[model samples]
Target: MGMTAPARWLVAVGSLLALTACAGTGGSPGGGTQRQIAVSTAVPDEPVTLTLAYTDDPPSKALIEGFTKRHPNVTIKPQMTPFNDYVKSIKLAMSSAQPPDVAQYNPGAMSSLVPAGLVLDLGPWAKAYGWNDRFPPATLETLSSDKTAKRFGTGALYAAPGGLSVLGVFYNKSLVKKVPKTLGDFETAMQQAKDAGHAPLSVGALQVGGFQIWNALLNVLGDVKQYRSWVYGEPNATIETDGARKAAETLTGWVRKGYVPAAANATADTDAQAEFAGGKSAFLITGNWAAAALEKQMGDDVGFFLMPGPTAEPPKVASGSSVSYAISSKTQHPNVAAAFLDYLSSPEAAKVQFEAGFMPVDTKTDMGGAGLPVEIKAAFTPVAQANGIVPFADYASPGMIDKLTPGVQGLISGKMATAGFLSSLQQSWNEHHGS
Candidate 1:
């Protein structure tokens, strides 16, 4: 019997990707012999055409533009979507007969796609391109399955990273000069801001923004090794733990003291960004992704601090995750898609994305000359150099967003107790993910 329509569609995408792999065998992606192998595999006459979808953000644009110039024959038609509706758009697009050749996807969404056999395996091309050694182990960790980090899960490396996306502290320059390193210092500073008649800390818990607060607290109070379970595990054991309550209590203090803005809980993302940019608040807890946005508004007037380290504990650390590139299972030109992936991680392409307002994940490529926002490179660079972990929020399913984000809004709104908040999270995780 012939395959079902969806199954045939899957086969078609896989075959297209494999068809490209079959044509050329030598050059790899990471440089040296890999570059030589890629060059020797030349199907230069073949045109690579792909459709990609992602949030219509600056870094994404810069990456796409750079990809085009490096391989003129390979063209990428980007299907940009608004941040609020991007997931929906991607879901719709992926279900179509002509899905994008590559698409940016979160871990859970990707996992779902993996089971459907919608995403192609990149192992063959990863080997052919030598991304095996070209990319960092951490990045490969995200691209790979939880089962193993050595290879792209499902045998194909469907995704590659654009940069290291980290979230932490963003603060106003005109409002505060010194950044606090420890939790105690942070408390003192928050008091100082309050005493000075300013909102000591600005938190925007609107809709899905609450995830950051939970993660930021964990960043300061939780144990590093066990944090992953807080995000991925099903038992919901984390909410009942000490770190969870401590983290909640710290945030509650900020709310009760009127250190957080009156409208903070109601405010969406732009509220915090605008407040920091305009100097309304002393500090904004956010991510490196906000670096470029702040640069345009605050320039040298902005700075960052890692989420507070333990008062008697180690230094405060920011959270980070690997940026990656993904190929469309529906793409007609797999080799061309691979070529762009190669260019993306290349020194030249890395500079383009870096200059477009982000820190490049490619260690070999120096972005110093790219002239990125000075405040970003100056502030977060040190914390990143100090090394931190990627918190649970970005790694888990969108369903997790439904759990923690609202809990955050409830916490800020005085609807939930610290213990209640943590207990809720524990219960929700177990109900969904399972113990």
Candidate 2:
């Protein structure tokens, strides 16, 4: 939980030193396993430039700033892109004789990229570090490769959790003084808002952005009752089984009742955030990551609740890992990379992110008065503690979004039946990824 001076340097700088060397030979200025980084305390004989490539919101910048302070010789450079385009960009980057030393990637879809010979297996590093004893079971599974060996779930410990995540309703405190804590209460509140001439909930759907919310609903109501094939890849998202039917029916009914925005399918992430922040909608289903954004925008006016099911106590919630950091098998500096990962788990780094508006992946670490994002914490922590958590959108395959999202849009718009929509989902996934 504490940090030594040397550990801090690797945690910060090593994460981003993505400068490329020839493809087959990854040896850096100081030859070491790509996984182990020299402790920041030791002044490097010379500058070691490391390049890290990942999506736009990468922690590379923060890491670089933190790491370089301790090790003047270590310089971290970033190759950042949009989240949607990250998969393609990383692949292109890794293909060159020069590959990024470290990167941030999605667990489900991005793991498929591992087969390209770009990823370094973290097995040895993991054994040495023994995160198995420090982290939770689901986390290892959640942050690990993928769900099935038939797919991309296991290989090496290429990546691990970088932040905390949970599921629940993000609602406008100013709009609804009292939040709905139970399913009946939530539904009644939605109806009350409609009668009072305000949109009760705002969700993105069929649009490029809204697909995730659709899956969130599935995890909460659908998976809680019936067997869900997509969660384990036993069936798939498109299968019109009981779980799929129930999920679709619940969402469609809400849509027909005018609880959510009609055109939410086209709403972008920023737009949805804005609408929720502006108080145009009473509730937005989300996790803890949104805490920082909301705080900067609205401050203390918003509140949160664990989404309730149709049962007795607090409802089972939906949750998944938000993002993870991984080492490049192609990096000449494996030790540096591994050392950086160790730095990330340190209380110092965890404290920085926690106070900066994120959750700590290490449960033992306390927030250093930076305060956990209340809305997110309220929504997800109970579910996680109760062992009711599940995987995120890309849990099954990289192809899920394209196959299932559009059909969800149709169901939400009242153009498709619950059963019919689910039937189409299975067919679509097969069409794209093949059965």
Candidate 3:
């Protein structure tokens, strides 16, 4: 089965916590008296070999091919790991005496490496490559953290996104007659679908899919800065707010109305997608990463849209993330690795990233095509330009996913109240980042 958004976080955070001991004891990778690597803006003519450890296949493998084709003298050896084993294995692998030159960056899984000084700071390289202008500021912000990795959006840069992902709504045109123009219109459409003897929405309450609905609601209704601050672990950040409560209540209201399937609590994300593709449901809320399989299954019968706000205009914000990578501190070829990272922002790489079923980090590059990809680009470009793409709520802390999965399940099953659900999420946030 295709990997779901929830499964990605499970593998990322679960593996990171399990191997805490492998993290380095040093300060932030950028700070301290660490020896500086001699690097240049130009790729070396001499023969060089570098290794990369990563989990995401399409962009990773395809990007490597693009980089090597440009610099034939440089050979890159990639070490691929399953998503489940990647966090734990990469931690040990990066901390080893002979580490890969580059590794994919997971804020949850590889965060420990920041303080341990196992990963390169990349600040110098960022300046050299002018990455500040090349990549999106928000994308780079998520990859950066403080010495303890507790706070983000400050300090030296760690990684660059090879590809991006956005969360939005996918509707079956065969079931829903037309697209919704406002949140009210959206709800009305859901009711209309339910009234017609079709499931209004296919939700995977068993995993991240359940909360993803809440996430979309919150994005349309809530303040983007407040949510971003909380996810970045700002001081005194809290998730227990009016907008959050409303989001919870709204989700529960859907359950009460039978718009969301009662069996959703038992259904996994892949199953939910399957149901939507099978035309059992009118809509599915998920990231663009699922676009390929969904397009293949539903074809022109499906269409995509951002979750609209109260008015006719869609919300400026959406929840999304990137498939990003970082350089290892112990690598002998920092420049070569930095060059590979730089290539991520190029027009060539943008095409490869898009063809491989991901949004390119170079948002300005044209991803011209047809169907869902075009629809996604149309919705995604404006948001990216406005810096409206924010990380998912579960990314606030390591244990937050543990709270979200069960809390959303409770909402779907009618076993938990709105206040209880919001309180549970706040408890997890408070535990990791104090009130």
Give each model's whole-structure lDDT.
0.61, 0.60, 0.82
lDDT of 2 at 112: 48
* TM-score for candidate 2: 0.80
- The runs of at least 3 residues in candidate 3 whose Cα sits more than 4 Å from the true structure, single-residue gaps closed, are 1-32, 56-58
Residue 240 accuracy (lDDT) in model 3: 79
Model 3 Cα shift for residue 355 (angstroms) = 0.4
Estimate the Cα RMSD of every predicted model relative to the unseen true structure: 9.2, 6.1, 8.5
The order of the candidates by lDDT, greatest first, is: 3, 1, 2
Which 10-residue span in candidate 1 carries the lowest summed lDDT? 27-36
Clashes of 1: 21
lDDT of 1 by residue, 189-243 (tens): 8788888878776667785455686677777787754565555442343656777
If scored against the real structure, what TM-score would every candidate get? 0.80, 0.80, 0.92
Q: Which of the predicted structures, 1 or 2, would earn the higher lDDT when compared with the native?
A: 1
TM-score result, candidate 1: 0.80
Q: Write the per-residue lDDT of candidate 3 for residues 11-66, one digit (tens) a residue.
A: 32222232112112223344566765655555667999999889846489898898
